[model samples]
Target: MKYLALWFFIIGVVLIVFIQFITSQNVKRLTEGNKRLLAEVAIQNRLRLLQNDVLTVESDIRGVVITDDRTHLSNVNDKIESIRREVSALRTDLRGEHAETYITELDTQVGRKIVFSQAILNAYDSKGKEAGEAVINTGRGKVLRDSIVQAVHQLDSIRQYRLNGIISNIENNGARARFMGVGLAIIACLACVLAFLYVVNKGRQQERMIQMLNESEKRIKEGAFIKEQFLANMSHEIRTPMNAILGFTNLLRRSSLTQQQQQYVDYIYSSSQNLLTLINDILDLSKIEAGMMHIEQTPFSLNGLVSSVQVMFADKAQQKGLQLTINVDPSTHDTLSGDPVRLTQVLINLLSNAIKFTERGFVHFEVRCLSQTDDEVVLQFRIKDSGVGIAPEKRKAIFERFQQAEAETTRKFGGTGLGLAIVKQLVDLQGGTIHVESEVGKGSEFIVRLPFRPIQNHTEAFAAPAEAVLNPVRGMRILVAEDNQMNQQLIRHLMRQWQMDHVMVSTGREAVEALRREPFTAVLMDIQMPEMDGYDATQAIRGELRSDVPIIAMTAHAMTGEKERCLSFGMNDYISKPLKEAELYAILQAYFRTADAQPAPAVVNLQYLRELSLGDTEFENAIVRQFIVQVPEELGLLQEAVQAGNKGQIKSIAHGMKSSVAYLGLTERLSPFLHRMEVEAVSGTDENHFQEDYEEVRRVCEQAVIEARALLSTSA
Candidate 1:
């Protein structure tokens, strides 16, 4: 459009110039004609003057008749010469035919008229009687005047014609210029319209693309949320059954079972292990999808890891009558640090897949050292099997989760097909690469290259050995505060198997009451119970009891933060259930060993001391004396609260007493009866409630007296 406008401006300028040129040319021609006309008018005037001069000369010669007229005739002749010179100049200046012819005719007529006038003057001078006749014969002067006027008229007509032509040319050129300008403007408008439409279309396309992107992002977020929820629920569902199976299997191991029963248990255990692995894989997939997966760096022995993998799969390969070989390059480092767990997972998946697909041929694992630096070592792991290989089309597709090379292969191999996918993700996360080379019915080789940094200080990497057998729990009395009947029974049975005595309570209230009345080694506190959860109960026990008793947390929720939350609430240790007997025993042994080393005070009845005592009289005597010194103040508060009839204060004091007595394992002697008293005090059932609690307290005091007497008798 700009270009067109420029062109129109140029054309307009050109037309203006052309108009000026043509007008100038026509004006020049008209000016020349006007000049000619003016010259003709001057010539005519001169001719008239000459004619008058000749007539006057004729009159002087005819009328005066030479008395004394010599000077007058001479003046007349000079005048006649000047007029002829003026007419000659006019004739010399003429150019065009009209002007030339007019000038020539004028000159001829003038000259003839002058001659005729001179003849008349001569006749008047020489023959005075013939002067009139000479004037009549001379018509040339009048004819010359008429010819000059005709030439002036013709010049005016030509000038007018040139002026009209110039004006017409200017009007024609301006019209053409206006037409060109309009055409150019139309073209520019069209171009602008097209540009605007193009821009609008492009903008629409970009806007549509942006809208699509926003929708896609929204859908992705929604899908991710749904996936996270599903994974959480699925993990819960799978882990619940899995916990029961694994927990019961562990329990069964302690029982005196026949070989057949043991085999059955083993089958269940192995199946549970496999199921747990599958669940873990699914959880991993969910983490990956949710962008929550994280990499952890740890030090591990590369040689030991590879050897373990070989040991795990070699037997399986042999069972299938396939040869399996694991070869590590001599140059490979024995110890390299990395995410050993993830690395092992990937390698196991690769090797397992290799073993699974191989029918008769050998499956080989070759570990080669690529390079080494101060911090990082590069290694290549290749698992090659001469077996039914993946087809060319299916090779890449096999890396997608839940997709195998063929459905038939999936059925025969019996896998979730998530292994390779997980392997790929893990390898990539480690900043490594994996590729597969395969041909159908020939073989497949999966190659992995990894970089790992070794631990800087090897001495710091050593971990103490775990004990093979647990220490025995002697006849220690334990307090079990579990609300569920079955769970309470389970704990009771577990404690009995360890030859330990325990007091079972249904609620935090009952537990506190029992703790006040009896002495036990430690408390097994459940985290989730009605009216009071474990956290609140532990806080109460810690605050009211004022004892650093070991409170092991037992809960079903095994979520990530549950353990920390449990410990943060004053639990000495945390265990998730379905509980493992060994884990529970370990916690018990930890607290019990410390408790046994410190004898209870003398306020605890001698009978309760005897139950906890290991035939050590000095130890028993020392603990009884300590208990005797501490229990009075605590018992005094309980008695005061009971007298005041403040149920809350009573419960608090009784709770403290219960924890102290339970820790001394006096539950069988003191807990049940004190618990009954506490139930009456809190229930406020009747005036007899306080009386009954008082009676129970009196009975406990009498038992303590009897136990103290027995102890003194034994010592004597």
Candidate 2:
């Protein structure tokens, strides 16, 4: 290491010295070039001026002869004085090999040209116009002017040639300097790297010994990291598709199918759900181990939680020839403040294990109040089951990951042994503790004691079923930013099924662009994408675009703290991947609760109608009534035309619809979709986006009709 440092220091010094040499060379070259350039430019400017002055004086002499205008002779002497000054300046500035010869000739020719011009002007004034004209026609003055110009140009050429030579030399010098500097710098870097590698190789023996000594400790630390990575990877890779599977399965089950097909689909759905549960258990255990699990303090109903858990496991328990029962003390607070999700997870894991192990006896779940206060309660959960019991010495081990009561229990019972471990972890995360009591021949009772706050303010602590809760007052134009094709399709199906309007974009950047171009009630942003991720998109929409269009993160990550992380990134809410249609709709519903009662921002721009009416109220009323009556019928005919491939009717109806929407000032929104229909009528290409666009058109026009009808009613 010391040798490597010394070598690096030497290389650094060399690099610095090389840079200094190159920079000094560049400075010297540039200074010389600049000084020469100024001198050359100055000389050239003087020559140009000297030539121009002589020409101007000659022009004045000719003007005094031709028009007899004395004003032309006004500046001739001042011009002569300027000419003399320019010749003097050029004499001082020029420094070429023939500088003296060129300047002497230029001075002489300039003097002769001025003398000729004065003679002509004097002839024009004293000897009359014919004498001056004759002198000019003699061509002597022309010869003098030509000689002056030739001398000035000769001097300019000399300066230009010298300047070009100097510039070429400077460039060549700079090129060489740069080439050498780059070569030396690259060599220095190479030497430094090689030396470091050599020294490290020499020191490897000691490093290897030290590494061997701490290998176990390193692995002990790495085990936790590996588990963390595994948990995160599973959350994204497994749970994302799992969210889609469960969501689409829900949709599939709703459709008509044969009995056998429905049964097969049910089996697939059950297996997918079970796989999802296992993935969640593993993630939960990892989160608890990493201290990433967070317990919420929201008010929830204890009875409702228990009832839901019972319903979840009742069928399984019955199929196993075991009864599932739940009992909550009547004195227990109806609204207890704790994490219902985490608590439900705990209850579900315990009950699942109870049912999994029990074959003959009932698996009894009881929630009892251990104690109570003004704002807090201690609840006791007893999950007792007549299952294969744990040995006295192994009860604690069963709570550890992947540990079963006996090694043979896994093979015999067909389980991962993660259920109990997850249950204990969940309880412990919520400031709770778990204990077990059992004998091998009898059963096991797992008791959990948890502290929760009682809510003084009564709240409706349970959500209704997804189907019952989804009552959207009006379809909101939502923008969905999702990358997964299947997930996108799933969300699309859900949106279409609910009769809500949505636009799908594949990336965050597209979502932001779309939002910027139009108005949407909410944004469903995906976390991972190609152009931009959800977090950055939300930030762009909030910090850059300054749009507070309720951004909900559609992430594949369902790990602990994900929701809070999303919230911190300016996301209003988050839905895990393989989206549950109900959860997605509910979150969207919350954001648009007020918007449902309101009309769209672009609903019906009345300015177009008002302009056409020109203060004629009756005309406006007639138009509005015609719109309310004719638009819906036209929209229906358009749909039928599209479905029936009536190209002529499609174009005719779309053109008419375009005019109708244009009259209502919806051209920017509705015109594009109607235009697409016209194109599709002609081309008839594309999967089905035109249909979705038609749906959007229909939705907007419905709102327009409602508002238009109200306008007429109020006017009447």
Please report the candidate that would top lDDT against the real structure. 2
Pairs that collide, model 2: 243-578, 244-578
Q: Any idea what lDDT model 1 has?
A: 0.65
Provide the lowest-lDDT 10-residue window in model 1: 458-467
- lDDT per residue as tens, model 1, 512-570: 67777876777888765778767888888788977677677776554445566877888
State the lDDT of candidate 2 residue by residue for 1-716, as single tens digits. Answer: 67667877688678868877887887788788888878778767767877777887888778778987777666777888888887777776654567689789988988888788778877877889899999999999889888888887887888789889878877887787788778877777777777777677768966987898699778867887787766766678776677778878878887999999899889989899778777777777777777777776654446545644554565577678887777789898765667777887788777877887777888898999999998679999999999888899998898888989998887887677788888877787788999889988688998999999875532112221111111236758889988887888888888898788999999889998998899898888888788898888889999888987888887778676777889899887676776655446545655654434643343666665565456878756766655665566666666765666656556556655765565556777787888887777677665535568778898878666656654553574
Local distance difference test scores for all models:
0.65, 0.75
For residue 172, what is the lDDT in candidate 1?
60
Error of 1 at 531 (Å): 9.5
Q: Per-prediction count of colliding residue pairs? A: 28, 2
Candidate 2 TM-score, C-alpha based? 0.49
Q: Model 1: number of clashes?
A: 28
